[model samples]
Target: MKSGTRHPTGYWAEEFMRPHQAFLAEGYQVDIATPQGRQPVVDELSLSLGYNDNDQKSVDDQRAYIAGVAALKAPLVLGKVNAADYDAVFVVGGHGPMQDLAVDPDIGNLANAILSNPKKVFSAVCHGPASLLSIFDKDGNWLFKGRKLTGFSNAEETQATFAGERVAEPDATGVPDRI
Candidate 1:
């Protein structure tokens, strides 16, 4: 998040794990990928007691689950992986992706490959859809132009940013609040 907020931002825990668990449960071989093949930073805020509805067990379980996943320890390099080798490309959502995945040309190429293949699936959640912005057709236009897509919306972003912060009431400018 380029906004003035100093809070550390990274991939949301549930955004990455829930779908991953579902894929594994269905006997799908999951491969984690990163722009540099390194383990991604987890947003500690997402695991907080407040965020988890005060469920300490859920936080602990999420932490344990991540710690035990060997694939996360050494993910595949996005630039080096062959898109055809996988049946699906799932970009996990986070503030971090907006920094790298959304702009990386390698990711753009990979996304295009995944989209061109009918048998392959391309899916993302929350901020994850931002990554799709990089995908373009051969003519250099956005691949999903005019297509309905979902992602972390502006309203949700506002709520998340001010979740526990105190702010002044809206002024007469009709701009609501400034970042």
Candidate 2:
């Protein structure tokens, strides 16, 4: 809901830009939510236009995304929005998400809701999928325990950044943490 910061670990910048633009153009109302409801800092490393340079289509898409983000309605306070309003949920990735999304009960709950429906698309990239680890079935078992997913791998995060390692990416597959 706020600006993201430059992270100790690296984030795949193009991945973040891609879906943000997709959702915006699909006519799906977009919202940025985070724990604590303050403006989260963007990871400067993830925002480098040079490093994550988009292709021509991607560039045009991002122009739309920038406009959409600039014009978004007031940030939805994560704790207040209900899940039913959304048709699908796409978690945007960044090292910043590793710092909070994993433990956010609301985000976890949202994942669970979206996962409950096979028709719904519950997706993410980079470290954003870490939030999936927080979700559980009715029995409290890990909901994404076996779901195919992607995340910022620890090796990817460590090798690409000043930060040697991070807890956000699980040691196993790009699946969620509870696995």
Judging by TM-score against the true structure, name the best candidate: 1
lDDT of 1 by residue, 1-179 (tens): 34445667788898888998999999999998889787888889889999999999999999998888889889899899899898899988887775567777778899899889998898888878778767778877777665666666676877876332434233343222322
Per-residue lDDT over 1-179 for candidate 2, one digit per residue giving the tens place of the 0 to 100 score = 11234435433445656676677678887776666555555455555555556455655554455445542334567777667777777776776676577778888787787767778877877667777767767877766565666556656645765344235344354343331
Best by lDDT: 1
Q: List ranges where model 1 is wrong by over 4 Å.
A: 1-5, 162-179
- Candidate 2 lDDT trough over 10 residues, lowest sum: 1-10
Error of 2 at 108 (Å): 0.7
